[model samples]
Target: MTHPTLLHRARVLAQRFGIDITRHPSDRTGDHLVRLLDRFEIDTVLDAGAHTGGYGTLLRGSGFTGRIVSFEPLTAARAQLHRAAEEDPYWTVLPYALGDTSGTIELNVAGNAGASSSALPMLPRHRAAAPGSAYTGRQKAEVRRLDELWEEITAPGERVFLKLDVQGYEGHVLRGAGDYLDEVVGLQTETSFVPLYEGGPLFDEALGHAQRELGMSVMSMVPGFTDPDSGQMLQCDLVLFKQSDAREAALV
Candidate 1:
């Protein structure tokens, strides 16, 4: 279902600022997305919240030889991730989640896919309509700070690209990365202006965090089909770049 309110608002804003939102594709991870990744010359990818290894499969299919470290907390999903990596030595699957601090927590599983799961306790009004009610079962999974994982998985002098789609946990995940932000060249995060999930931040707030704390600049925002340009805000996929890396990339 398309969100007319969101589309209307986005279109109005685009008209006012002379921004071209028409060219932004609904599926951000298409050829255009791959082209953007190529521009950064990204070798290694940190696939935070990699659901069923679809993104990893896409990257490998596109000739990305660099290592992919995927993190998924759900038990069933992790099995699928393992299967996807069975033949690919470069892919390492981690059956865990990333947070500001490392410890075990309750992972609320929704019947749907990655978008439905959350680390938070309660479901938001918007997500209440999501297929399958929240599961009460709990799992003991290792939660690590991003900095620690980066040190463990990445080699020195390797430029890193992070793709964070951890439902509502993006802020906490970014916070955990701390000083390791310097090692990253590019990032793609799922943002929500409205509370699509239980604990997600608003679009402006998430963008501000990326700028002030993460030391990154917004490169682009791709709206989902439900989020049109004009009305009720939904979710967006945001691309970001470290200021220094962005400048260097521009010169290339």
Candidate 2:
């Protein structure tokens, strides 16, 4: 599809799903990401990999008054996030990175500011070299497991919506967030069938793990362009919801 036509379709899909995608950048408010949170019934949102706070800003603008915790690991991006949060009282910006384990780890910074970051250990293979690569490099950053972070932030019986866009670290983030899985009503993650990040699991394997271990099932795919059951391969966003919560969401 042509760029304009594709964008028009995306806008229609976003409106159908009750998301304000027109104002945000395409990379930030794709159809899959919006649909994933469409059924969430909570105010508290966790915007993991919240690059420039686009999602958080959009949620609040759409009347989500609950707390939004935005996490970004990159120094420059975190600075932007902090500035964005300053304009909104409900949004909280954190500089720590999240993964399956807690410690300091090397983050591969890519040339493209948007897709240029990952915490995977095996980096040399996935690093893209170009003019963008000039801005790309590796840096040590503090990391924590989502489960641990959830324990510190969540209250009793509070519903949480999580959006994960950490290049290829989705599986690791989910793996470390076992405690928060049951509490999470919705999840929006970028999934890759190809090895975009070194040592990252394939999309199917990651989705299976989310379904079996995290108590979430596939709710939608990004761009609204793929069949949930189609055995095709592509890199896209994967929306997930707790099985029980999904049923309730459907009933609503």
Candidate 3:
């Protein structure tokens, strides 16, 4: 008996099921980021929880010519991040996690890599949806306060943009960024509508924290993760800018 290859089997199955797996949300979300970049006149970016430097690649490919300081907590991802940005003078990757305070934190490394790895644990719902995202192990990552690194990461007069894809730890990162929120013009963050990770904030709480407490307003939102079976949105990425008279003027 001969076994069919995975690609061949998928093609046959797709024809039978009328499925299209080629859809990508980045085509839309990437456009949104570019518009926000231009609208805010952003020249610098703070990329938190950058995995394998994917976001950096997206920014460069989308024609963004600015300085990007990316922070990754995992060892393997940081190694990949270094290689990905080696040729780009404006892109730099650091081997540390950002949190509410400066210290060491244990990261639950996921076997799937795209799964949640945070101070909190994964709940049953997330585990069931993506069983391969099981915790393979744990690693102690050196954490840094974004405020302490702000001076070193940016030029003297640069207006900053912030992107947070820190799984379930977005709130912790935002808490740490309070001291320098005024310097930032825009923010993009991932929020989950459901309880994906144990102790993780829901979508409303996370968005409210940024809007009400951090002085940011949601400008646009795009679908992030989705359930292929039910066609339900699991997560989304929000584009936000600081709420101030200056921001209103810039948009006008």
Candidate 4:
């Protein structure tokens, strides 16, 4: 490992170049996520809305050895996702979308390599931020509730973490978790600040649903999806943690 003094100096020098580094990269979200996994002894991760297995790769890169079940709907993306998962025996990719019900839904495939694909309609705000992410086409995809596959993906008494990057369809995904929501030790979902996707819940609504309904507490928030022109943040990833008791206490 590198020396602590050199690391500190590097962080300070990087700041002089107008780069903001938190106490630990200014509280990086992924760091907190891995910390949760280690602290809670997480064994299985449900990678919801996993585009091309990028999230699964991140988890492995971050030292998570647990099982990863990724969900991807688009054909082209799933093709890449399958190729990526070929190396990791523990990482499994499923070609489907997680929603409130199990059925077929039209998924909007974005031009930007399905990076902005979603079951919900994208609004002007989202399109303006990344023109390349504009809707390219649509395809019918099978939707399944997380609870429906809980037994197949995980075992009882195993700590499970659910990460959602389903664009604006997070609400339905959470609902589909069913009773598994209470058992989820850690949760991460992309919450939009502005109207990125039409008819989707905003930041406060999503946060409220996690805390009030799902009995989870906000552990960290990582900024994402900023407008290039205005430089305003449009969305962020909310990382939450839940304890076995009330599931209502701050992590600190």
Q: Say which candidate scores most in lDDT.
A: 4
lDDT of 4 by residue, 37-118 (tens): 7776788999988888877877787788999999998998899999989999999999889999999999998887888888
1-252 in candidate 3: lDDT tens per residue?
Answer: 989777656644442232234446466667768877977888898999898998898888787898999999898888889999999998988988998899899999876663356667887766655565667899999998888888889888788999998878887887787668777788888989999877778889878877887688888987665554455677888888887738567667
The candidate that wins on TM-score is 3
Candidate 1 stretches greater than 4 Å from native? 1-28, 133-136, 225-233, 246-252
**Per-candidate TM-score against the hidden true structure:** 0.79, 0.74, 0.88, 0.85
Candidate 2 local accuracy as lDDT?
Answer: 0.68
**What tens-digit string does per-residue lDDT give for candidate 2 at 80-198?**
78888897777788888888889888887755564446776433323321223233478778899888888677777878878887877877777788766777887877776656566
Worst 10 residues of 3 by lDDT: 12-21
What C-alpha lDDT values do all the predictions have? 0.73, 0.68, 0.79, 0.81
Q: Candidate 1 versus the native: TM-score?
A: 0.79
Clashes of 3: 0
**Tens-digit per-residue lDDT, 1-252, candidate 1:** 976677666665543322325543434455555666667777789999998897788777665777899999888888899999989988999977999999887777654543456786534444333323344465566788998878788988877889998878888888889898777888888877666666678788888877886678776776642422344445678988777675456766
Task: Return the lDDT, model 1, position 59.
Answer: 76
Q: Pairs clashing in candidate 2?
A: 110-116, 111-132
Q: Counting only residues 3 or more apart in sequence or on different chains, how many pairs clash (N, Cα, C under 3 Å) in candidate 4?
A: 2
